[model samples]
Target: MNYTLHQLQVFVKVVQTQSITKAAEELFLTQPGVSIQLKNFQDQFDIPLTEVIGRQLYVTDFGKEIAELANEILDKVQAIDYRTAAFKGILSGRLKISSASTGKYVMPYFLSDFLKEHPGVDLTIDVTNKSKVIQSLENNEVDFGLVSVLPDRLKVDEELLVVNKLYLVGNKDHMPKTAKETKEIFNQVPMIYREQGSATRLIMESFFERTKIKVKKKMELTSNEAVKQAVIAGLGYSIMPLIGIRNEIYNGELQIVPVAGFPIMSDWRLIWLKNKKLSPLAVNYLEYVRTHKADIINKSFSWIDLAQKAHKH
Candidate 1:
């Protein structure tokens, strides 16, 4: 059987996305073109690699094995490109990253400087929840995964990028101004919660467990923005990352409820699979983050201090 690396690349993306249309879009090729390449690649082996059921694509068992091998081949090719670019004293390549939904607020600030400095590097970011982000890391689909909570089950390397502090927030008119008052009002007030599998939800649950406080959960929403809007409309209270609610807090649409043991802190980490070999681009990004973590943290969270001051006045 004979196939080009480009065909393998296309096939791998098709499997990753589970949709030919999405794969085509990412590859910047027409759907029919991607389909033709996939057909040709499969014909060489005369085996079914994928099938569609109920409008959803599913990779065959054999396809899973092929995808694994394809990933290995692609990694080696990327390594060669990285090494060549390094020898030429230039850094250039696509850098794929996955981050938890909440990281949507934080990662861009950290990534902005890197993108500006390494204009040759192409960047792709997948904003998803914690579970999907970890799945991408485990599959070696991304160079890095940004999350506040590290999975205990995955063997991975992690770098602490910053501290993520969560604040209990609600509509200004509904929120109590002091810790003791908020504690007394907790069980009586309806609480809007992030959906299951959210890092913020997990952290909030852990906080509740530790404090022995029970919440009257009224609604579950999929995104931070949704939860924020719900709280703004006076539906309920929510524990949200300080990064996500700074603007709302500054504008007085939301106020941090001074709940006991407020600002539950967690470490925001950049993670990658431990045994996976890093390409030069990945290595450079890791080093850049490590060397400038302090600056990244200060720049990212300086608004928190300002927001607090604004809230006081």
Candidate 2:
């Protein structure tokens, strides 16, 4: 073979640990054996893959390039192993995922149950806005992303998970006194906005345009928690995911306001690379969501309704 899989493994280990001795300990090999394997790979390539910085090993630029490719190759090899195990009736492995902010409201609820049923699978989650989550998906930093915004030129495979309504929220105490009064004050109160490129902001803006309404924004913030806190603190009012603010509404911290002519809807999407292979763990986790999404949504709506009723009481 080119340098043998063991040589590549040794080289990757050294690059990852940045210490030949650590790599040797991790790989259950002697330090000399690890050094020899690395040297063999370097000899095959006719250039040093790594260099010594003081006593620490540093990966050369060429080594970094190979390390990147090596990660992909290793991922593919693990995928093959997962596929074989799946064929023989096993579901296991790690599944890294990313999601937009609003997805945080619903994804955790579903993911918790999914994890309960599939204890063998490890899960990692990164919560961010639409743009960064998509970027992470594109960079292969995550296996898939749950997003509310769909880009024009999506370079990934996507499936609609569930669609949820966006809502206009304000502190009940600041809810314009009455509906007509609210309309007049709506333009007066500062409209709090999420950071730019937020799916919620995009949807809200699109809704305003279609309804021919101009909302005056008082300020902008980067987090749902911050936006909700500002609204509750009576600093300004804003739009947010209905599901996300259910608890706040129930606790009388926020109010859901209805716009006369505006429709607020967002589709939550599950996205992955177009030609990438999914490990069994990812496939099963996704399948679990697909099968139970309706029930999940229903349960969520029920909770919100209950919260609303309690608030009214």
Candidate 3:
């Protein structure tokens, strides 16, 4: 019944990945080293923690239970560390944010300076789809949420940060040569789409529906990056935010093709429940953003303005 934290970590990782090789790779341990740690961990337990059959691995039901407990223990241990930093007069606590997936490109710019100044802050950022971002806000699960579109049903206050411009993009070699009507262009090249409920997908859909245009829908992908890759492979074109694909445009791998109603725009917003109490850490982070957002946007995000100028009609 005795095991070290190291053993618990190895066992938890093995349970999570269900593969010795993947656990080892993620933990930066040699495969043999991980195997030995796992074996040592299992030695202290009575019942089976894992099983192998036909070269596939499965964690026993008991193993899943242990892994969950071990994860809780690890989180408690990290909390202790954060508390220690607080005792030393450093700003310490959790600063958690759940962001929509495309927000991966935007949130870091806003967070970097604050995080750099407060190294004691234990930061947790979850980059997920739009619904999950809203869910996290509704449940009070995170200190903040980042999204380009405000949820109609949520009673939340938002701080506007930056402009998010979505454009019709395709692989440079595969796009139409001249500007065409929105519906015609969509028909000329099959439209790659983000999965249902994605904000960008809604924008694209509503835009076409309003214009009374019918588009040929090809592959439906779950993520912005996935849709971009599909377009780059010449499968289809998609509407993508410029923030996420600027490098591809600069590299000539992708192009922001011109159409009549070209750039769809939204504001990137930091949102939280209207009446929710904020932790001191969250308050400090918000203040930093309130004061520094403009400066950060001017300094770090000037490239966005340059990209916008090119899209101007």
Candidate 4:
């Protein structure tokens, strides 16, 4: 019947991580500290909140329900704290962004500086598929949407950050040996595909159709990392954003094969409804991204241009 907010926070984190040690790491507490708090909190309840079986922790159904309520409580507590900071004349409020899954590779770089400049700002970023990202925009659920391919249905203002180029990549063994071989490479190498609604998958499909290249679908995955790992493991070749797979290419685990017509280009843009009322926090974030976009690209994404050039020939 009696519990502290810290106890609730620790319990919710334990429920999320399913391990006292993992929860301790995230909370920056010692393992024994987390375990003691979890134990003390659980002792207040008659029914078991968590159970240990075969040395693995599992949250009971009631524990999950309680953790959800605890998370909501924490969020409200944060909102109150931010409001108090605003009262003290500090810039503080929520800045929410919904981004397409692949945009994950770029969005963080764009946000890092703004977040550092506004310590009081609360950020909620949803990284999902293009459809859900657009749907979130349409539903007015977020202040901005980060997308590589613009949605035709949305009438939005955009901050164009950087050029997004999708390249055909495979392990070294599957690469084309000559310019002529580039046109015929798909005949031998199987293709790994992103899930149906991803912009990458859509662009790759359109390219294949337009070029009349027969593709053998090796498998379909729901995200960029999954497809990239599949390609790295020699499962199949994939059309991936060079931004996401740059490290693998540098490490020689993947190679960009120059197709006769390749590197499908698009722009990653931060979009907001043309006339949506802007929150102060959102406005500041907008200014921050618009002003620092070039610097962020030059510093964090300087490799993109070089990579493109290497495979352009």
| Per-residue lDDT of candidate 4, residues 1-313 (tens digit) | 8899999999999998999999999999999999999999999989899999999999999888889899999989988998899899998988899989989999999888778887888789998888888899899989999998888878999999999988888888656555353668788778999887788888888898998889888999999999988888888888999889988988899988767677788888999999999988888788888788889999999899998777655
Tens digit of per-residue lDDT, candidate 1, span 1-313: 7899999999999999999999999999999999999999988876789988999989999999999999999989987886677688878888999999989887887789999998778789999899999999888889999999998799999998777878888898876544453566687678899888899999989988888888898999999999999999999999999888877887899988766676788888899999889987899999999888888778667776676575445
lDDT of each structure?
Answer: 0.87, 0.78, 0.88, 0.88
Error of 1 at 9 (Å): 2.6
TM of each candidate vs. truth: 0.78, 0.68, 0.89, 0.80
Q: After superposing candidate 4, which stretches have Cα over 4 Å from the reference?
A: 45-65, 122-143, 151-157, 177-183, 232-235, 247-253, 272-278
Clashing pairs in 4: none
Where is model 4 poorest over a 10-residue stretch in terms of lDDT?
174-183
Query: Number of the top candidate by TM-score?
Result: 3
lDDT of 1 at 80: 86
Candidate 3 lDDT by residue in tens digits, 60-175: 99988989999999889988987888888889888999999999998999989888999888789999888888999888889899999899899998899989988898998887
Better of 1 and 2 by lDDT: 1
How far off is residue 272 in model 2, in Å?
A: 2.7
Q: Which stretches in model 1 have alpha-carbon errors above 4 Å?
A: 52-58, 92-98, 120-145, 149-160, 172-180, 251-253, 258-260, 271-283, 298-300
Model 3 alpha-carbon drift over 4 Å, by segment: 137-141, 181-183
Order candidates by lDDT, high to low: 3, 4, 1, 2
